[model samples]
Target: MISIELFAIGLVLKGPEIPWWLLALVIATGQIGGKLLHYYAARGSIRLPPFLRRKSANERTGRWREYLEKFRANCHRRPVWTGAVLLISAASSLPPFAAVAVIAGWAKVPLVTFLVTGFVGRFVRFGALAIAPGIVIGWL
Candidate 1:
């Protein structure tokens, strides 16, 4: 399968065709791969630059730690809704997927939940995008 640009062109102009399911699969896989990479990077950033990992309770890092703890607590309180929003954001590309992934990682979302949500969201998003051109053409 080709890129999003080419896929869009194919949808709009009726260019070369691959089954819609295959295109959706490829796009979803690519999206999830990028998302996972972003998540891991955010997780790893906690240890980055020793200066930012201070142990002092009064330091800036300590404040960051407190904020993360509160966020984690919120996540625990509304795990299902949080995950649903994350999935919807990923699928719709709203509020930016990278930002959401980083937040999820920083909040320590379960790996399985993150992966599953990301995959489902990405698949649905790409599938909808793939069909959008046809819908517009029909309306026109």
Candidate 2:
């Protein structure tokens, strides 16, 4: 997510000109829409770009595949944990939500779980950001 740009927009829209929830909803919608594309690509429902595909059977690609396999196995074993991680990533961007989106897709997380968690988390995140400027200014 473009944190700086969102925060700046929140600052500009700090007053009653626009509701914070509306701004949050719009941003969350866009973020989840893009992430859904990534999820589908990883699920093989959508084609991946050439750069994302393996061009050669190199050591790096091999290692990455192995790592992904392990991750996939873990996801299958502990789906709730995986969903929790996705929620956290969406909310705080602690581990980068884009990477998590790919992982969730590859791991075959249920579409409902992905959409619900991602949307709720993103809504919370952007809503807080949208209101932050107003709150801070009120304290001043």
Predicted model with the maximum TM-score: 2
lDDT of each: 0.77, 0.84
CA displacement after TM-score superposition, residue 89 of candidate 1 (Å): 0.9
- Which number leads on lDDT? 2
Q: What stretches of model 2 exceed 4 Å from their correct place?
A: 1-15, 57-62
Error of 2 at 70 (Å): 1.9
Clashing pairs in 2: none
What is the C-alpha lDDT profile of model 1 across 16-119, one tens digit per residue? 36565677788889888988877876777435566645476566466767887887788779889778978898888787887889888878888888899889
**What lDDT tens digits, residue by residue, belong to model 2 across residues 1-140?**
45654564655565556788888898899999999999999889998789988687665456778888988898889988888988999999888888889888988988988999999988988888877777877999
Instruction: Kindly report the root-mean-square deviation of model 1 from the true structure over all alpha carbons.
Output: 4.4
Each prediction's RMSD over C-alphas, in Å, is 4.4, 2.5
